[model samples]
Target chain A: SQTIHQWPATLVQPVGSPLSLECTVEGTSNPNLYWYRQAAGRGLQLLFYSVGIGQISSEVPQNLSASRPQDRQFILSSKKLLLSDSGFYLCAWSPRAGATNEKLFFGSGTQLSVL
Target chain B: GESVGLHLPTLSVQEGDNSIINCAYSNSASDYFIWYKQESGKGPQFIIDIRSNMDKRQGQRVTVLLNKTVKHLSLQIAATQPGDSAVYFCAENIAQRGSNYKLTFGKGTLLTVNP
Candidate 1:
C-alpha cells in the first residue's frame, strides 16, 4: 500500500522566518505530487504540482514554491513567510496513469501559524 | 474563471439516517469529479469518485452521483454515523491549458451526525 507523510504537524513562526515543509511517498514511484492550502472555512487552493523529478508547475502566484528533489520526495518552501501565508497545508499524491490520476490521496496536513 | 460550489454550508442529521450532500460546478470541460471528507485538523480524505462516462459510483457505504447536463454532483452516505461527521468537499478535474490536470474544489459542507 502507498502512504504519504508530511511534517511538521504544527508550526508557529515569526512573519519573516523562512519555511520548509516536506512530504514523501512510499510504495510508489514517479507519482504525481501536489501541494494545497486551505484557509478557515474555505476551499483548497492548489499551490504546486509535479509529475516528475525536477519538474514543478505552480498554480497560483505566491511567496511559496515547491520542488520535487527525488521521485517520491517533495518540498514546499518560502524565503520569507507573511502573515497571510498562514493556513492548513496538505500534501497529496496520485498515480501517474493519465486520467485515472483524478483520485488524490492526501496526507495529514500541517497547521502553520504565522505570527 | 470556473469554480465549484456547494449548496449548503452545514447539515445536521440523526444517526442511522441517510445523508445527502450536493455540489454545483461551472466548468463544462470538467470530465472527472471526486468527493472528499475532512475531519477537523486533518487532510481531505478521498471518499469516492465518478467520471463523466458514469452517472453514479458506489463505495463501501457511500455513493457519488454526477449530472453533467445540470452541472451538479452529489454524495450520499447510508446510515449516517457519528464517525461520518466531517466537512465534505467536491472537486472537479479539468485540464490546465493542455497541461497536467488540475482540481477545482468547492467550499466544503459541514456534516454533523447526532446520536
Candidate 2:
C-alpha cells in the first residue's frame, strides 16, 4: 500500500520567519504531487502541483512556494512567512496513468500557526 | 468565476439514521467530481468519486449522486455513526487545455452525528 508522510504535524512560527514543510510518498513512483491549504471556511485550495521532478504548476499566488526536489519527495517552502500563511497544509498524490479520473491520496497534513 | 458550493454549512444527525449532504457547482464543463471527509486538524480524505458518465456510485455505506442537469452532487451516508462526524467537501475537476486537470473544492459542510 502507498503512504504519505508529512513532518512537523504542528508548527508555531513567528511572523517573517522561514517556513519549510516536507512531504514524501512511499510505495509509488512518478506520482502526481500536489499541495493544498484549507482555512476555517475556505475549502481545500490548491496551491501547487507537480507532474514530475523539477516541474511544478501553481494554482494560487501567495507567500508559499512548492518544489519537487526528487521523485516521491515534495517540499513546500517560504523565505518569509506571513500571518495569512497560517492554515492546514496538505500534501497529496495521484496516479499519472493518462486517465482523467485519478483519485488523490492525502497525507496527515501540517497545521501551521503563524504568530 | 466557476466554483463548487454546498447548500448547507452544517448538519446534525442522530446515530443510526441516514444523512445527506448536498453540493452545487457552477461549471458545466466539469467532467469529474469527488467527495472528501476531513476531521478537525487533519487533511481531507477521499470518500468517493463519480464521473460525468455515471449518475451514481456506491462504496460501503456511502453513496454519491451526480446530477449533471442541475449541476448538483450529493453524498448519502447510511446508518450514520458518531465517528462519521466531520466536514464533507465536494470537488470538481476542471481540465486545463493541454495540461493536467485541476480539482477545485467547495466550502464544505460540517456533519455532526449525535449519539
Candidate 3:
C-alpha cells in the first residue's frame, strides 16, 4: 500500500513570511504528485503537479512554487505568504504512466493559517 | 468551451434518500471522467470514475453515469448517510496514452446529508 505524508499538519504564520510545506510518498517511486489548496467550505484548487524530479506544471499561478527534489518527495514553497494563501493544503499522488494513471490518492492535508 | 460544470452549488438530502449530483462537460475530446469527495478540512478523495465507452459504472453504494453526446456526467448515491456529507467535484481528462493526465475540475457541489 502507498501512503503520503504532509506536514506540518497545521501552521500559523504572519503575512509576508516565508512558507514551506513538505509532502512525501512511501512505498511508491517516481509517482506523479500534486499540490492543491482548498479554502474553507470550497473546492480544491490545483497549484502544481510534478511528473518527475525537478519537473513541475502549475495550474494556477499564485504566490506559490513547487519542486520535486527526489522521486518520492515534493515540496511547496513561497518566498512570502499572503492572507489569501490561508487554506487547507493537500498532497496527492497517483501511479505514473505504467500504473493506474488517473486515480489520485491524497494525504491527510495541512491546515495553513496566514494571519 | 471545453469545461465541466455543476448544476447546483449545494444539495441537502435526507438520510437514506437517493442523491443525484449532476455535472456537464463541454469537451468532446475528453474520454475519461471522475468524481471526488472532499470532506471539511480534508483532501479530495476519489469516489468513482467512468470512461466514455461506458454510459454507466457502478461501485459500492455509488454509481456514475456518463453521456458522451451531451458531454454530461452524474453520480448517484443510494441511501445517503451523514458520512456522505461533503463537497463533490467532477473532473475530466483527455483520452490518450502517455497523456500528462491533467484533470479539469468543476467548481463543486456541496452535499449535506441530514440525519
| DockQ of every candidate structure | 0.63, 0.69, 0.51
Ranking by lDDT: 1, 2, 3
Off by over 4 Å in 2: B97-99
Best by TM-score: 2
lDDT of 2 by residue, B1-115 (tens): 4389999999999999999999999989898999999998888899999999999999999999999999999999999999999999999997765446678889999999999
The candidate that wins on lDDT is: 1
Reference-based lDDT, each prediction: 0.92, 0.91, 0.88
Error of 2 at A79 (Å): 0.8
- Per-residue lDDT of A3-115 in model 1, one digit per residue for the tens? 99999999999999999999999998789899999999888998999989999999889999999989999999999999999999999998775555368899999999999
Q: What is the TM-score of each candidate against the true structure?
A: 0.95, 0.96, 0.93
Give the per-residue lDDT of model 2 (tens digit) for A1-115.
9999998899999999999999999998889999999877668888999989999998878888899999999999999999999999999998764776677889999989999
- lDDT tens digits, residue span A4-115, model 3: 9999989999999999999999998778899988777666778899989999999877999999999999999999999999999999988786733377889989999999
Q: Residues B86-109, candidate 1, lDDT per residue (tens digit)?
A: 999999997654336778899999
Q: For every model in order, what is the number of clashing pairs?
A: 0, 0, 0
lDDT of 2: 0.91
